[model samples]
Target: MSTLSLRGIVRQFGPLRVIHGIDLDIAQGEFVVFVGPSGCGKSTLLRIIAGLDQPNGGQITIDGRDVTGTRAAERGLAMVFQSYALYPHMTVRQNLAFGLENQRMAKEEVARRVAEAARMLQIEHLLARKPGQLSGGQRQRVAIGRTVTREPGIFLFDEPLSNLDAELRVQMRVELTALHKRLQATMIYVTHDQTEAMTMADRIVVLRAGRIEQQGSPLELYNRPANKFVAGFIGSPRMNFLDGQAVGGRSVAFEGLPNLDIPAARETTEGEAVTLGVRPEHLAFTDGAGLPGTVDIVEQMGGESYIYVTLANEARLTVRRPGQTQLHAGEPVRVAIDGAAHLFGRGDDEHAITPRRLP
Candidate 1:
């Protein structure tokens, strides 16, 4: 395991600067994930770390040693890519042994490492199977096994499960988590999927337009986003946003509705243009405690249902409820917002706002 640090990292393609100056400190054995929309320079940043691409300006240090000008081969890192780059003709064991062979490792040592990796991955029975004979999940596992045999100081995964089906992705996520526990190596994962970042990362680095938008734990970004973008990006079914003006400290005058008091103090003064944010699960159905809305759609998912309701102001809202609950489209309902609502100033900076309680 090793510590990885980047200071003033910058990447430019022609006149277009893709990655702006970024700084990060990754502790040894920490599992950090970089997540953002496509074209956000996440992949570019990872490539810079692996020495696959040199940064325009920055210092990269691994284990306290500067490796900014180092070659990828000399970086002492194992990378598992999205496309399982396993040789189709080679069996699982041969594929795992190939890297060690290139370094002129003893045949016995190579075999030992391959055997150990196979056992760890529970693919011992597939040793003789070629890539063509394995399923997508199996191929991905072989790719990971190849990395395991290298036993590098760090492991880098670039959306390794994006090619798999939903079920396989979930299964592979569990396996990857277990693998991390067993190896305890520093890992940096890159993905656009928020769920993957939320579930797997010790800390998530949310990027936008080649810049770091936010960096924190999943819950932190979800519950207290730094801006409207972070708040909307980190959650499933996303938080609802409504245009409003700050009525008082932590309270906003929601359009067509009474003054909604937020639970926290507003950083800005009254009458500032702001957007109110409330998560779907925070909404409760009440007789008259909530803003009135008519259901537009309801999606049932075994254990829970997502009710899509359009409010009087024409803003769409989704409310999550137990699966047994019945809410139909075209039905008028009052959905109450909790004291946990978030507010974002017009400048897009996240502002602290207090949520008001109902009578």
Candidate 2:
């Protein structure tokens, strides 16, 4: 386990600045995940940490050592790439032993490490098989085992599960989480998958436009997003944002719905535009008047259903309902926003209109 810190990290390609000046601190043995959409610099940041890509500026320290210029090999970090970069000619045992051999470890010690890693990954029986003979899941485990035998101070994963099937991805995610707990190694994983980040990370770092939009525990980010972008980004099915205007203090009227309660502190200069942010799961199909809409789509998932409603103003909202509601397309539906639903200053997209101070 080791701590990592990045100070004023910057990465640029010619005049195109991809990673803005960023600073972050990662605790020893912490499982941190970097997640964002495509071209968001999550992978670039991970590469910088692994010493694969040199930052245009800033300092990177690992375990109290300023390893900013250290070679990837000397950084004492092992990286698991998305491609499962196993040698085609080598057996699983050989692949696991390769790194130890490069370091001139004794044959007996190398064998011992390989055996231990295989057992840890529950793939001891697959040792004699080549990469071609292994399934995708097995291959991924081998890739991870290859890193494990190195006994690296830090482990870096770069979308290592992107290549697997959906079911396999979920299964591998569980295995990886368990492995992290057992090893208690400092892990920094980069992925575009929110489900992966939400489920696996002790802390999730949300990135956008080369900046750290927000960083927090999964639930914290989910329940109390810092801004509109985060509110929409963190949740499954996404949060719905509708055009609204603060009519007066502590009240905001939706364009096509009744006035909903706003935090008293929400700045409401006459006709000040704002966006009302409500999450699908936080909303309920109510009997009383709420946001009136027509059900546009219904997705049934056995025990639950997702009702996608399109408001008269053209804004779409998704609501999670219990079991299968006899909802069909064009059915009249009303979704009551949880009073605590977020409101944000429309143009700036940062100001949270909800009560800044919680009771």
User: Per model, how many backbone clashes are there?
Assistant: 9, 0
Which 10-residue span in candidate 2 carries the lowest summed lDDT? 350-359
Model 1, residue 111: C-alpha shift (Å): 0.5
Task: Report the lDDT tens digits of candidate 1 across residue range 23-67.
Answer: 999999999999999999999999999999999999999999999
RMSD of every candidate to native, in Å, equals 2.0, 1.8
Stretches off by above 4 angstroms in model 1 are 348-359
List per-prediction Cα lDDT, in the order shown: 0.87, 0.88
Highest TM-score: give the candidate number.
2
lDDT of 2 by residue, 16-113 (tens): 99999989999999999999999999999999999999999999999889999889999999999999899999999999999999999999999999
Highest-scoring model, lDDT: 2
lDDT of 2 at 36: 92
